[model samples]
Target: MSFLDGKSLEPRDEAYRTHEITKKGLPLSAIWKGDANSISQLTVFRHFDSASVSEGFIGEGPNTVWVIDYPTLERIYYDLVVNFDVFGSVSHQILTRMYMDYLRMESEALFLSFLPVADREPILKHWYRGALAQAKVFYGHSHLLIDTPAAIHYGGKDPKNELIRMIGTRSMRSTHSARPTTNYVPSDLKVLDNLSAKKSLWLRYLPELSYVVVHDDHGEITNVISMVVNRAHANVSFIFGEEDRRIPEEDTLMLVNGLLGSYPNFIFWIDQSEIGKFADAAKQVSDTKSMDQWVARYGVRRTDPRIWSVLDRLHYYKQHYYKQKDGESEGLLDVSRYENL
Candidate 1:
């Protein structure tokens, strides 16, 4: 029989028969007290550690009824036995719940990659349905729950100042409604090269521009913009490989400084293993403040809130699915932790 068909039968019939509970010596008197002739059949069952009898009664003599609510009983027993929380001790319940939530968010983010970008909004809206309600529980004001975009325009004569002002203004804005009017042109590469060349400490760890973010028609990397100002941690993270594949510390620091010049409050994160490389590079360069002021390192602990937030953001941007080469870890928290749970 199908599992659904088995489930449809009364629990007592199939469960009792399968277990041969009559051998356990459960008295039929516990099931019903009725007319002797009315007694049709008797069955006994063991559920968890408790035993009970199910008796078929047709007519009443000295009618007394006994009922065992197995489902509710089992739930109560399991909760008491498995979920008992001790006083003055930390409970894994909260951490486990948060980890599960992170996994759910990651899964939702991955699913978005399968959809066309144009169709993503409606799906995202549906998925974030109760977010406002949940936010309301924590924040007293309704205005705080709503997202409002800010606008800033940069119009100046100096090219360097204009570029800095434009990025800083955009970084300050709460939402990005339009793509940047300025593209990362070939001339912009000269600008970055010139800026790095002037700085004695700039390690030229430039990866291909494509590796940073996929550009749209306007040549703007929207995902990078979104992730740099992500609400959860307001941190940007980079994962590097060992030896040859490792991103240059100079390039990472330079990028961090450029972003920090615009958003002073932003944090930058790197893999825990790469911290020594950055430190060693920092010793050679005079710009040690960038590393000290904004940088943090993280390991593989899935329970770390910052790591969880970073993974969620990266997954949302479709940046977490890249294949790793030999001797390189993806720096992603193991999703199997939640899967196993």
Candidate 2:
């Protein structure tokens, strides 16, 4: 509750102090209607508690969630906040970036704990597509991780996505959140998801995050969604040649309900009537010229007569409607990166 906006906690006893704290002061439901069902299944863990669930940590990948612990948590705080210097020399910057790679791998390893033992290495290998000998070996040899088998069992061939599904069902069973965690609502997102699976360049032209305002056939606003493009990386190990590490054909996409991310690279307005065509057009995007034409069709450009009006309505819906319904804060979204397209 301390983490969620409009949610809070107070000691029952006014005189209570940190030294006097002995157990959890609130139940899991007080925090989440049902939180961490997958984690609570871990009966082998001796020190697991509701406090750990309250931490509310998550990993980088689609299905990867987390419960951060003290040492690594401290290291994370120090690694980026204390040890890093924005004004440092090029070598210093390179070293900082290099250190972050191993930290990311550790976080990824925590996600690996939930997968079936046999599937773990294979999935990780895909994540590290072009990783060199040392980078590949580093994950298996890490002292920071333990081989904790998942308490949950799987029955399907696709356990990775199955686990992801279970997590969503359990966590969202009681919340009033009007959002989709993964996959996507419209068929468009599924198209992007499927194309990525087949190693298509479907997501290559999209920015890191794009805001989409969907309207009904009657021209009434229906929903606002964000398209998140996750560019596939062969390896983050090497300090240079970022272009070489990129896997454009395998780039993937995620669509989340409501506003997401700090910088929205593009803002798009689409009537529900043309939404299907939009996805089809995205799948067929072959080059920059094609993308420009597509943008001209759906995008709200800087020169659009109603540009500010469109932005205002997006903000109005986010602050007045979504914020009240979801209990999630709706802060100002950044548009400094808005695409001229």
Candidate 3:
């Protein structure tokens, strides 16, 4: 028996509307509507988990078939890679290679497959925090002291951004003291002592120099330390620097656990390295053959419905609420829309 023989893959109720809206911009939908025909053949297959398949099936069975030209299918693949932020550049390349390999193995056009969305916020957050912590551990020899004016001007009200900007700013006027040696000492080893010292310094000089950025050298800037003062409480949140290198999963997990034990409140951002590491680890742990296989097998199951809902709302915003430019519009999508996703 086929894997999808008894299963209904059709969308239900609101999901049907969501499906239709998402398909509007898809290449497969365009091909089905006869908008373009540049391919020799296109084939759609339903992905199924082998574990869920009945014993009689050869492997996981495919269902919900669609046939189009090869050129059309290739166009769809390119469209997905270009339009979707769902996969990073490396991941996109991997997917493209996987598609080609699968096509070669099966001797048919590989067209459409279902992918579930996953909630990556927590994992991303953890990874980001770990990067910051790791930066401090690996590169904490140089320190950059930023004056209050630069911190205020660049960061505005956000303490985190203010701290990051203070370190990131290229202007020399904002930099009170560049690469202060004494401050480069590892503070994590003496966090309590450093906190007390920081508090005292804040009490005396909080109004003058409110932020600081610490680094090892001026080369690649793999790590940087930032600090913001809380004037009212006469306290400081010592923000560790971020690293660009891909930290191992075990290292990140250990670092996070260690940091949590040391500092109750630690701030970090999920850098590309951590994100890539997490994705690789997830692929390894998954029962599927590859990252592409995992996506095919569980993409829809991991997909967050809120993405579709937000897209629908954004469409509404663009149509009814957004201001028009000469009866036309510019790109309606913003980076903020994918912040939580």
Q: What is the lDDT of candidate 2?
A: 0.58
* Cα lDDT, all candidates: 0.29, 0.58, 0.26
Q: List model 3 lDDT by residue over 263-312, tens digit each.
A: 11112222323434433433253322454443332221114453454344
RMSD of each: 29.0, 10.9, 27.8
lDDT of 3 at 47: 14
What is the clash count for each candidate, in the order shown? 0, 0, 15
Residue 103, model 1: lDDT of: 29
* Candidate 2, 50-156: lDDT as tens digits: 11111111222343333233444676788778988888899887766666665566556555655667777777776666774654555545422233444456899
Across 1-341, the per-residue lDDT of candidate 1 in tens digits comes to 32123232245333433454322222222222223233323332221123333332111111111133344335344544556454424445443333333323333332232233443345444434435343223222211112211112224433223322333344324233232222232222222222332343333321121112223454322333211111111111111222333223322111211111111222224333333453344335344455333232312233446545654554444433323211222343234322100
Highest lDDT, which number? 2
Deviating ranges (above 4 Å) for candidate 2: 1-67, 82-95, 136-152, 169-184, 187-194, 197-202, 216-220, 280-289, 325-328
What's the TM-score of each model vs. the native? 0.18, 0.66, 0.14
Query: Highest TM-score: which candidate?
Result: 2
Decide which is better by TM-score, 1 or 3.
Answer: 1
